[model samples]
Target chain A: MREIQAEEITSVVAEAIKNINFHIRPDVKAELQRALEEEASPLGRQSLQLLLENAQMAAAGVLPLCQDTGTTVIFAEVGQEVRIVGASLEEALQAGVRLATREGRLRHSIAVHPLSRGNSGDNTPAVVHYHPIPGKALKLFVMAKGGGCENASAMAMLPPLASRHGVGDYIVNIIRTNGAAACPPLIIGIGLGGNFETAPLLAKRALLRKIGEFSPDPETAKLEKVLLRRINELGIGPQGWGGSITALSVSIETAPCHIASLPVAVNVECHSHRLTEVKI
Target chain B: MSATWLKLPLEPLVLRDLKVGQWVNLSGSLYTARDAALKQIFDLEADNKQPPVDLKGQLIYFVGPTPPAPGESVGSAGPTTSRRMEHFIPALIEAGVSGIMGKGPLSQSTVKELQRKGIIYLAAAGGAGAFYGSKVRGATITAYEELGPEAIYCMHIENFPAVVAIDLEGGDLFEQGPKTYRKET
Candidate 1:
């Protein structure tokens, strides 16, 4: 059995939060550069150029990539053979989030209540998902999900007979209606064939994948390509001012479901597309 | 097209000259407010009480910036989604606010109100916070300090980049831009 200190988790989470906020993942940066070269609209090209410059400035530590440092979402995959020492996993992760927000100067965006609208000053009680795996190592996936894009996420439980084209239509409609509100040139994550709740979770998880990474399954990969083409064809472009590249990439994660249902969820991510992973 | 350089508290005539897709680099004084600050202003006005800041002829930015790092004027200050403020914007327009800077499209009703009021709506690059923050030369909290980042800040900005998403004549880029560029598939 592998023994891991809880403080190690806290330190790792803290550093990961700080790093992800400061740096745009290289793959996302590359895609933005490509989009900048290909964007036809003058406004779209300008927006992409500014986005690229923002990434550069953020990497230099001038300021964070976004003002919305985002609600910290952590996915922890813990092996059954590993035991956590000292504080519990949840406590450790929350401590790490509080540290990052305070030391890194991230925005404290969490509200204490929905209606009262109270601010959680330190941005605590992170939304964490835990999974038990067979190996001795622990893996952490962290994402700073902006409120604008999170508000745009959707899930539907369709009849089992719903066609794949119908699923594609729903996604297109959501993007069309969202327009510039969700920060276009978005990274789209799709979850298919899961149960009612898991579908959305799968979609959110799919976002943690590196941009441009496709599913190993041939059918799913083809669907990703088709959706990407159709979405860009909508001309939502960068910041939705209009161009040919509405989405940088489309990724899908699928699961087996009961015979009676075809559940799907779409989680839209803004151009910032901030996510990072670490294994310990 | 090259961007037009305009100073804030923009005159109606200057605003009228802006087209839907034109780029702009705005400078001079601007006030920042998002959902919380807007609500407070509305509540105070409803009670017939003095609000914290004067709105007449002022430009409001719908943003909640991150806290500045040491030696910086402000943190990454970027535009938030503007739809959430749609409920409260008409009141601000009635109060003589000249224009709004934000991201995303305004509702049709909001667009009509802006046109009637001769107000302008500008779109800042939404996620380009670091780049925008660098343009802000100074920031001071003007009201609602208790709201933290959501507080109203009077900011001095130089050459802040934006697009005229909605002009004084009710031209809207969000609606028209897509229609012009969309490929018939």
Candidate 2:
């Protein structure tokens, strides 16, 4: 077994958390630039320009791209071949989050409880999900999801008879109601055919996809295009400032569900769309 | 006549146009407080004790900035939801806060109160943290160190760009703008 020091994991995780807040990923940047060219709405085009400018400023001067640095949601793929030597893996990750909150100067957006609502100043413990993988390197996918886009997310359980059209209608309605509230030119990530909670998770996972990239399945890609076209028709515009392009792209993911249940979920990402992945 | 219009940034258009949201930004003073800080301000007022900072015609940002690294002004400074502080806004307005800066919607009650009190709620673009951070030329804590990120920070700003969400006359961009564009589906 390859031995990896827990301290090393902690340090890497800390830097990863910090780097994501301060920098926009190259892939996301490229996509924003492309969207600027394709966006027809003069207002959307302007909003995209500001977004690009914000990304550039944040990257160069070490400013946070958006104010809501958000909670540290870390997706860890642990290598079965690697053994952590010093501290507990969970503790190490939590430590990394603490360091990021304190040192990185990222916002402490996490509340202790949904009902009681107490602030957890350090933004810990992180929402860490671990999966075993056959490799020597640990992969961490860190995303800082702001509350605006997060608030726009929807999960619904439709009957088996729910047609593709029905699901599409629901997704469009969500964006229309959300209006400028979700910070438009959003990335609409849709998940179809999964259990309740799993469906939302799948939708969020779909957002990890690079902007404008398509699903491997032609059917899913076609559906994505249709949804994208319908959403932009709503005229939500950038910052709700008025525009033609409501969304930059749409991505859909699906997994088999119970024969009786047709579940659907939508996770909208604002223009900032902050996320990054690191392997160590 | 009851007076309450010392609030400099009057409306969304005026605020940006008058350069209240412009560069030169601000150098001398500003106040930092959030939900909890507002409560403390009111609590002190209720007790007939002086609130820590003087908010006369002063700018107050509704932010709980991240902890600063060694030798930094402040980290990732950005506005929090103004709607959350709706309950405490009237009191703050009455107490003489000139400008309120935050993101998202303000409650109708808060909008009415701002109109009555002649105050304005500014909407800094949400998720424009880095852009927002660039305007903060300097920062230091003046109260509630225990509040950490939510502590009262005295921030110096330069040409900070923010849209007027709530104006002195009760016009709110967050309300009127979206309501205009909200399609009947």
Report the number of the highest-DockQ candidate. 1
Local accuracy of candidate 1 as per-residue lDDT tens digits, B52-72: 888899899999999998887
Candidate 1: list runs displaced more than 4 Å. none
Report residue B171 deviation for candidate 2 (angstroms).
4.7
lDDT of each: 0.90, 0.73
lDDT tens readout by residue for model 1, A74-192:
99999999988999989989999999998889998999998998999999878999999998999999989999999888988888888889989988888888857998899999999
Error of 2 at A135 (Å): 4.6
The number of the candidate with the highest TM-score is 1
Q: What C-alpha lDDT does candidate 2 achieve relative to the native structure?
A: 0.73
RMSD in angstroms between candidate 2 and the native structure over all alpha carbons: 5.0
Instruction: State in Å the error of residue A121, model 2.
Output: 4.3
Model 2 residue B153 distance off true place after TM-score fit, in angstroms = 2.7
The positional error of residue B125 in candidate 2, measured at the CA in angstroms, is: 1.9
Q: Model 2, A1-280: lDDT tens per residue?
A: 8898888888888888778887887877777777678765553465577677788787863567776787677788999998988898899899998887767667777789886667787888688878899979888888888776788788889888887888898888888766467767688788898899888888888888888898999988988888888887665666654456678788899999999999999998887776888888
Q: List the residue pairs that clash in candidate 2.
A: A64-B130, A66-B127, A66-B129, B22-B159, B23-B159, B25-B159
